[model samples]
Target: METQLSAARVSIRKGKAKPFWYGHPLVFSGAIQKVDGSPEAGECVDVLDQNGNRIGWGVFNPHSDYRVRLLCLAEENAPDYAIQDLVKRRLEEAVLVRRSLGLPSDETNAYRLFNSEGDRLSGLTIDCFGDVLVVASSALWVEKYRAEIEAAMRDVIKPRVIVWRQVNAPLRQDGVSEIIQTISEETVTVRELGVNYQVALGAGQKTGFYFDQRENRALIRSLAHGRSVLDVCCYTGGFALNAARGGATNVVAVDSSAPAIENAKANAALNGIEDVEFICADAIEAMQGAEGANLVVLDPPKLARTERDLHRAIPYYRELNKAALECLGTGGLLFTCSCSAAVSVDLFLEMLRDAAHDAHRRISLLKITRAAADHPLVPAFPEGDYLKCFLVAVA
Candidate 1:
């Protein structure tokens, strides 16, 4: 007795249902063998195995390489399920998890509220900045269900303002042309672990702040005592400020963005920190003369936007890390990071190793960390494991 999950059925190619069976949410166009009841984009459709057995359900998109992003497995797949309520339910679940982690507390009022695939909601990310919420929509389903999602967020997060944003590349990939914000607010000051930063509501970079590096900055603060530190691509002086607060004798931070440099300087003033120097310069050029610093941080922006650019982005990282290694001597520390989702942990570490070898430096990896706890990893979806960090002790 075979039961169809929905009116529109998408059958997986033979031998392609394994990944979906393991809870892998993405169903690419190539993996599908047949589609019945020609579902329109952003329509809720049931996914089936080659044998015509219902396996999962997800929203469909004809224009995307990822044709369907599975929202639930067969067990949870039921009759008359309100697809719109899934967004509300999943968002509430994400919020509950964040609350359990003590997010938006006295010390830290900013963090990632929803992490897309990591939270089982593909193409939607929510970052909280005090009372302001920034919603980054990167999928057709998210754009289609924007109203329902907003209602859910309001009930769950209760933010005073919400700003909608979409990465141009992702929007194109998802076949979503554009998205707009329902509300906006002025800049807000957010505190993270005793350090104060003035975040320009929708300016700077991704969601206006690097909350994924929260734990990493705190880790840098712990190890920066009495060291001369260089923070490259120092957006808003996150690592630099933490380094100065951590008793770094001298801090030189550099970024290509003039606005970022100005914001960093302002943040320095906000914290009454005068020891850190904010420089408006390209990261690679700035690092060439960044010697004498015992502690160096190389947190560059995303270089690999797509999988096709993986090979190209690797050489870039190799050169960047080599330059960073040149600034450090024996026993010096190098805190390097990559936020490219296309770059895997093994590949990133290998690139770091290649950089060290090319620089003629023997380094001991002290620790390897990823995005803070709020950004969880979904094993099946390795792309969810973006933001890889490495702590090295040069020898």
Candidate 2:
């Protein structure tokens, strides 16, 4: 008689092998055997070595190329833990880390509570904006723990509303349905660096606003006082709004996305700020035509999707940076950034150097910035790290 488990059994194939690998137990093989001991797919299972010791546990998807995505590795016969327990423990740990950093104060209620793999929570991320929490799920396990995650958010931080964003492309590839569910209130107000932002949890870009750039925006504002500033790809006018509020004489924001331009205008209005101008145009074109601006910001979207896309994306960055350099006045500031994980910090700096050379100007590095404290990066996993900003002065 064969041992029984709830997961399906998938045939393991090796290179040019005819006989299927058998009697090999995996903690999560996505392979389930029937009462008669047959194979099936898309089930969760535990994998074990030939010695009958548990190796790892994961969800199995035979239809997709990946047979198993391990969630955990634990010894066999361990007490079965509910998904809720896992979510609660992770949330508590995240909260503890933030408190240690002295975040979540009266002035700034917006910060990242969980950053998916960064926080060791695997496929779940939660961003808190004032009284609202935006949740993005990228794996089936996270979807399974949805209710528990929401409960933890309420019990731990007591946010006014929790918005669920299940439309991530990776989740759909895993055969998971996408649905935006509002777990609590409809509106939430969050303050960041003394600026109050009104966010509608039901409808907004990834988690309502761009919390990752919170620190960078504040830094730009500090340096932009009395300067003529230009913000490229200024989503929701984060940098632009901050520049104007920081006493910049003039601030112009540009983006190709119409919706983004609209949102930037609305954000400016929300702050009762009128010194900034929003332009719905390609940033590259805007940079080429921009003149008399001493401070230029070039924050393009992720141009490189993967390692294969890097070669092509490098030229685009070089061109954009070169254009910004050409537009900047003498002794002007250039704040440029790349949010591509494939683009390393060293490579990004080299590209900027190359751009400066091509534009016939020398630049002195002012400061280097990364994602805010909320978006922590694990040393072992570089993929969790993205968002690199460079502050330079054209000479």
Candidate 3:
């Protein structure tokens, strides 16, 4: 058994503190110091303090103004350890959580195992598509434990393949070389709600298909039958295709990205279905010209990058919703969503209400949706709960 730290001795001071004697392999703490000997962001250092005194650890951003994001208080005489243990433990916990949710490992091959800080594993993300695993290491700690993480996946999960899509450019600023590796196979297919999706292991957005919207798409399918559906910002036509399968009379899918439109068309073709229209244009313009659509689905991408961007984004959301409402027939359904973490669900709901008023239309909120079960949220981390979907009926 590893010896646990007794208690931490922490004090706020300026300057580097020397390590005290301790009966532990590792003692670490981050210090706040500037480049020119001025007080700046703190530095994380192994505690060489005497007598095994507990040391504090935190996140330190050297470039930005704020320097230390203290994660945990240090304890005295804590065992010195490698980051490999941390990564392994986090993955185990994530796996256990998914198992508790009754998620079949074989049914839907694509899912997220670890959501960076959300999983208490900082700077690392793991996405599983069937037997293939894609890993993105964004932090130095995760980079150090990469091999251990891969080994853990092999021993525990036994994934057929693993790929490392390292973000090296930003790490270069910190003097870290990015490592891209194909640890396993080069391709994999994922099943989402009974639909088969073939994605390149090394390519595609984030982790290929967006599994976060799995449940929401199912909900849209249930409501889209016998309706004229319009899917704005329809990347790859997940919603549009599902709506078509749901027996929609006709579906119009629009996106600004040409490649996305092509992929949507391809996805439609893959399903061997017709009676769907693909438009490569701005979502707002597409919504403006949309007519005779009883159901308008607006699953726009994140518009507000930060809190400061929200003020500018609210008007855009309002305008977009207003345009959709303008073409929505009476008693029509409007499935809208805002994936921006900066935009709170309350604020988004209010924006839609205001947009309806601006368009001189009355709308009733039918239901609200969030990310699927696979994307678990930690109570301490509100950022993990970013997805918000609203099903409204325009009266």
Candidate 4:
């Protein structure tokens, strides 16, 4: 741990400590009354109430609307609140939680090791693809403490390669690190539930794979026996391969990305599962052409990037889902999902209802699922629960 230093302090606006008190990790700019000292961007700052009472410690960012990301409350705080110590403890805790669930077992070697706010390391997410660790950081504090973070991860997981990536950086140059780029290599083959996949750590979407859907893929396997599955937006075919492994009569996987379709085919070959038809086409158009699949899964990318995008996104979701529901045979099953944190379950449910009505289909909700155990959620942070899956029986 680093030596204790007298850090800068920021006072919360009068009566604005309620959310922080309730365990919400974010403090918006509007909630801050004044800064007691001049702190550099991504500097550790002590959070104080209007009355000068210590509230907690947090990372401060002047540029972002979310000005402070709370690290730990004073009551439950650690003895040494150093960046390295905090990161190591949090990483170790996350690993232990996953180990408790028996993840990275004989059947699986890929999973989320650390989920940003969910693991209390706000704006930092790390995923494991076998020996490769893919990191995505939104917090500038991570850049300053990058060496510490890597060291802690090495102590816990000895990953062969660590690729650093950024999401939504203000500047393109700021998004990437030259040192990390020089050290990191590209692709690695990983397994999940006995399924083989080739993951591109530096190039692939959101840490190369969606390990959060591991349990959901198992659910697809359970329900796919003897059915013809249609997997729309099947990036590298996570669900389609599971369906094939589960003895689906036939599996048709479609994705707009040519590379993804090619990778899906390679994964099928790697798994020695030959009953899949990989198609590179727009998911909406492909869903429109579906031929009465007994099982249909619609897992698209984040359609609504922010709350402001809901108007445009809702209609897109409705249309895509309507097409999928229309292609489902009577008594078929549908595993539909939306990964947009901006989109709430209530709003998604409403859109699904409208889609079913448009498709002239009767739907019975069978199960509501979310991300796998590795991506744990903070009860106070609704944004932490980004994945929403609806397993329904359609007629």
- What are the RMSD figures for all models against the true structure? 3.2, 6.0, 6.5, 2.3
In the range 1-395, model 1's lDDT, one tens digit per residue, is 12333558899999999888877888999999989998998888888999988887888999999999898777864443355567677887888898899987898988998998888888889998888889888888888877878888887778898888766677788887654543444688888877888876656567788889999999999999999999999988999999999999999999999988999999999989999888999887888877699999999999998889988999999999999998899989999999988898889889989999999999998999989998977788886787889999999
In model 4, the Cα lDDT at residue 159 comes to 89
* Model 3 misplaced regions, further than 4 Å: 1-80, 105-107, 167-185
In model 1, the Cα lDDT at residue 310 comes to 89
Predicted model with the maximum lDDT: 1
**Weakest 10 consecutive residues, lDDT, candidate 3?**
19-28
Over 4 Å off in model 4, which ranges? 1-3, 169-184
- Which structure is stronger by TM-score: 1 or 4? 4
Q: Which ten residues in a row have the lowest lDDT in candidate 2?
A: 16-25
What ranking emerges by TM-score with the best candidate at the front? 4, 1, 2, 3
lDDT (tens digit, per residue) of candidate 4 on 1-395: 57676779989999999778767888888999999888877778899888998878988787677788888778866753588878888898998999998977888988998998899888889998888888887676777678988988888889887888766542232332333332345878888999989877777677778888999999999988999999999998999999998989999999999999998999999988888999999988898887869899999999987899999999999999899898886799889999998988899999999999999999989899999999998887876888999988886
TM-score, candidate 3, is: 0.79
Q: What TM-score does each of the candidates earn?
A: 0.94, 0.82, 0.79, 0.95
Which of candidates 2 and 4 is the stronger one according to lDDT?
4
Give per-residue CA lDDT, model 2, range 1-395, as digits (tens). 11234653233322311111221212222232211223244345554444344445555554433445544445333323344544566688899998887789886888888987677555678988766778877766567556767877777778766778874666766666654554444766668877777666666566777788989999998998899999999977889988998899999999999988887787788888988888999878998888789999889888996789998999999999999999886789999999889999999999999999999989999899999888877564567678999999987
Candidates, ranked, lDDT = 1, 4, 2, 3
